[model samples]
Target: EEALRGLKMAMKADSPAKDTAAIVIEPVLGEGGFYAAPASFLKEIRKICDENGILMIADEVQSGFGRTGKMFAVEHSGVEPDIMTMAKSMADGMPISAIVGTDTVMDSSGPNSLGGTYTGSPTACAAALAVFDVFKEEDILGKSQRLGDKLRKRFDQWQEQFPHVDNVRNLGPMAAIELVTDKTSKEPRADFAAAVTKKAKENGLILLSCGMYGNTIRFLMPVTIEDNILEEGLAIVEQALKEIG
Candidate 1:
């Protein structure tokens, strides 16, 4: 509710309402920590966009294609966006992106109206099609959900064991752990997060840190990772935490 109020206030403070065109949001914030927006907040945003005659664009580049145990993160909110942009896992690193929109909005432009220098490359399309085939054949969504459960369990254990490990969260396999000075104060411990990532890297695990205060260690492991490999990587993270915590 506070977030919605802030949005409304910002929109009102934008001066001319006619200048507003669309409200773009990431259903699950990627680079700004792995926080998933509440479903109610998303629904409210949809209503606001409809009432204000503004298009709602969902940026699903990081949270799309079964990353969140769903086809798209917005699907969890049951909110249909006016426009959606997807990439990253779409082609499994084939360097392709796509934009989808409602028929009314899409048809507003003439055929062949949208084109980029490398738009609609045949190779990239083939890679994307292959990816879809693999998704159906391998039950990727189910694997993602199971992976998320495993990650959440591990994070919970870490939170209980380590004093600095706080605010462990995830939207399916997109998980993160925030390092703080203490549980009561909740002061961000950017140094701890950096040290852990550096130690993890030295121990043969690639870990990334994100968030506004750079105290968040986000996990972006592949859904198809083998059980042994996943455990090995997680063990490395635990070792790093023990050494740095």
Candidate 2:
């Protein structure tokens, strides 16, 4: 995203900050919006960070591990992050988080510095590993790609049919639609967004809404969801949108 790119440039410009630089970002800006940053932007930022000795940090809490058609969203760009943070769905809601980094960066931190009381406790790790196995065995990553594609097509259909829908986008299972009264002005229609989300929940689609302006509906389908179930959820959304429109 431009935020990371701009931060990198700002660091280079600031003599003091330049020496202490760490570029943190979400490859797929989730709550800010369910939009995936262009891969080209990611590549440029990676090159800039490398040349400037800055570390690129990807917040994959919302876009990692079978969520973005890749094991990790970083695979979309093929540019490795110096440090990647994760965990929202690592183990069936068994709260966990991690900071994966290069050996050098990891070694920089001392021993016994980051583990939690539950960190790496056998049960969680074993369960997470089992989830990983299921993901691979069931081709969950491929399903994510198809799910995103289906979501985009459905979103586009809504956008074309409904004038109030300003934009529709998909990033793996993270798809969203924005409502606007003035398409040219792109003024957020928060009322419409909230009302539809409420209706969708009533109609059986447990959607979430969180954007800078609170005018977007976000969907995060479980990667392991069956096609019939996924379609059922989307159908609920479509019905809700129809009623709201």
Best model number under lDDT: 1
41-112 per-residue lDDT for model 1 (tens digits): 999999988888899999999999999999899999999999999998999988899889999889898988
lDDT, candidate 1, equals: 0.93
Error of 2 at 131 (Å): 1.3
- What TM-score does structure 2 among the candidates reach? 0.90
User: Pick by TM-score: which candidate is best?
Assistant: 1
The residue pairs that clash in candidate 1, if any, are none
> How high is the lDDT of residue 169 in model 2?
82
